[model samples]
Target: MKRTEKKRKDIIDAAIDEFREQGFLGARTTSIAQKANVSSRTLYNHFESKEALFEAISEIMLEQNRSMQPVAYDPSRDFVEQLKDALWGYISIITEETAIGLNRMVLSELIRDLDRSRKFFTETETHDYPMTQLIGEAMDAGVIRKADPVFATNQLLALAKNFFFWPEFFLGENPTPEGVMDDCIAMFMAHYKTGS
Candidate 1:
């Protein structure tokens, strides 16, 4: 990588550590600069503001977990099986240490800045995620009853969040219970899947 690019990456990496250790509101750019071995001015040269830095950090987080992006829905495939694969992939990504730290930073930001939190949520959850598109396709193929794709998406995601994400985030609870993922898929399909 170019020298400038390396410095820029160092700044973002340091900022993520600072943000996770101290919430975004509590973190200081000077601390990040020191940790990155760059001057505060150099940090500003790369990112104009803390919000911009946070955005960069989010992009890095997404790039690191790009494998979690769901595959395209295949109408010929079993809907429940496809949904399970997609949902489980997402759960695996979010449960990673870096992803959980990012979630904590975002949730902490939410308490202080609703607009920023909303932007983060929209960027991460609504726009890029493939689950909604799959749900919509399932609806079109009559594998699932017609409904608001977003609502169905939320329902499926909420179930996984309740079972695996939120509890682990909030309580440091273990999410390794056997059959939990399968149970969530079964429950969701029972309610949403359509019959002949």
Candidate 2:
């Protein structure tokens, strides 16, 4: 079982690398098999088809990302501190070259296949379980006011997303700089900050 798990992980990692480099349609199972140092037959035993392997890679990446998120916001922290934590989390994760490449691959896939684009959106959206839960709690406690949690989620997420996601997608050099987080939190809090 341990050996099977290791082989599975090896194949998934190889497939992820291949798909990201070549896009899904362009990626080759033979290349992935060679990269994983596994025979074609062994690879097929692990994954039924190229689509199966790619979906496996996508699900694994999504689940891995979801698993790393925090469970909830610290109720004890001030709203501004919480906002900073959320914003900083987005900045820290998405700024990396690996994350950028993954996003680029998703966008390219979206152009050819709407379903693939939706896959990326679904993975990114509901997958941040911790943050979504916190947004609910904050609304319940009167720390922020919104009729619907989803609306609040959109607003808060939009604050952090537009800043870097735009720059990332366009390869724009300017990023939200180090000092800007504080100002961001300040602006965000001015709009929604409240007491329990």
Candidate 3:
């Protein structure tokens, strides 16, 4: 990578660590500069402000996990196997510490700055995530039946997260024990497959 690109990456990493540890409100440009081993001026040279840095954070997370989606149901794979693969993939990526920390930081920002949070939520979640598209496809294909795809998408994500993942973040340990991924996938599949 070019020298400028490397410095940009360095600043981004530093910002992520500070934002995760201190949140948007509490995170300091000085601390981020220290972590990046750059002057504060250099940090600003890459990103004009903390909000811009947070926008970079949002962009990075979305890019990395963009492909994390429900497996398009294939005739070849059995329903259970495909469901397990799709749901587990989504949950595992989104439930990681980095992802969770991002969410918490954004949520905190939401409380302080409703307009920014709402705008961020709409742009990022609506365009970047395929949550609605995934569930809608599942419904159209008869994998799941007679449901509001938007509501289903939200609830299913919340179920996997709130029931299985959030506490883990708060406690500083993921609760996904042995086979929990499989079990969680199966449990949600059970909901999706309930006979119409």
How many residue pairs collide in each prediction? 0, 0, 0
lDDT of 2 by residue, 1-196 (tens): 6998888888987887888788888999999999999999999999999988866656655775676565365678886677577667766676666666666665676688888778767767775544566677777778776546666666666766677666766774546676765765666566766642
Question: Lowest lDDT 10-mer window, candidate 2?
Answer: 187-196
TM-score of 3: 0.77
In terms of TM-score, which candidate is strongest? Answer: 1
TM-score of 1: 0.84
| TM of each candidate vs. truth | 0.84, 0.80, 0.77
lDDT by residue for model 1 over 125-177, one digit each (tens)? 53545587788888888888889887888888888888889877887776558
Model 3 C-alpha lDDT per residue in residues 1-196, reported as the tens digit of each score: 9988998999988888898788788999999999999999999999999989988887776676666543455655565565555566676787787787776666666778888877766765554234556567667877777587777767666666765567766776765564765666566667778584
Instruction: Give the TM-score comparing model 2 with the true structure, all chains together.
Output: 0.80
By lDDT, the candidates rank as: 1, 3, 2
Candidate 1 lDDT trough over 10 residues, lowest sum: 62-71
Candidate 2 residues lying further than 4 Å off, grouped into runs, are: 70-75, 119-125, 165-174, 193-196
lDDT of residue 51 for candidate 1: 84
- Give candidate 3 regions above 4 Å deviation: 128-138, 146-148, 176-195
